[model samples]
Target: MKCPLCGCEKAHKHGKTSKGGQRYLCPHCKKTFTDTFDTIYYRRHLNTDEVHSILQSHTEGSSLRGISRITQRAYGTVVSLVRAASQKAQIVHNAKVQKIKTKEVIGNEMWSFVEKNKKPVSQKN
Candidate 1:
């Protein structure tokens, strides 16, 4: 395995995580990291299918509490998952939208001025 911290290919098995994923140790960087390090799923207990279900339910107009009840997850977990997903989507949107080129823009404007006095200025004076 390769060491993620130092980009070294001399990594050895250090231990196993609580979830049974193998942990690697890098001699060069003297650091221990797992295969999931730095990933969105890192440290997350929920599996992919569960998270997908939660997001799908949320997009289908399910409330956080309702999602929690439906998915059998805690309400706080549902809220946090939704918030994290929203943040990720916003970031992706900003990145992709920046690359789009605007071909054309159609617009119009009108300008007008109104006077309180209806009489001609010369006649009023």
Candidate 2:
């Protein structure tokens, strides 16, 4: 396959990493890549299917450590992904809020600030 970054067709399999991921070298661009290129976990050594399974487990209410154990990923990485996904979901939900000026416009900046500072509690703990 051609190198996705530079569209270089002159590529060859360099070697495999200790994690068993295949590595490729592009002679045209002098760049190295693995199977995870153009993906969220491109630089990560974790398996693509394993990461997807971890994400699925997180979505299904599994703990970050639990997902990490199942997928053989760092606990911190799993937690980071879970938190980032939750924040993205919250942002999307907030973006869809319709502005309805009922009883004239009201100022609630202080309350909003407080809400922002509120700690997010997990259902499991």
Error of 2 at 67 (Å): 5.0
47-122, model 1: which lDDT tens digit per residue? 9899889888887777777888988899778777777777676688788867656888664432211123376557
User: Model 1 scores what on Cα lDDT?
Assistant: 0.77
TM-score of model 2 (CA atoms): 0.49
Tell me the tens digit of each residue's lDDT in model 2 across 1-125. Answer: 69988998888899996777899999998998987676556666555676678768766667666777877778778766655555665687689866865887765321111123467776895
Q: Against the hidden reference, what TM-scores do the models get?
A: 0.62, 0.49
Whole-model Cα lDDT of every candidate shown, in order: 0.77, 0.70
Candidate 2's C-alpha runs over 4 A off are 45-50, 62-75, 82-125
| Shift in Å, residue 65, candidate 1 | 0.6
Sliding window of 10 residues with minimal summed lDDT for model 1:
108-117
With a 3 Å backbone cut-off (N, CA, C), the pairs that clash in candidate 2 are: none
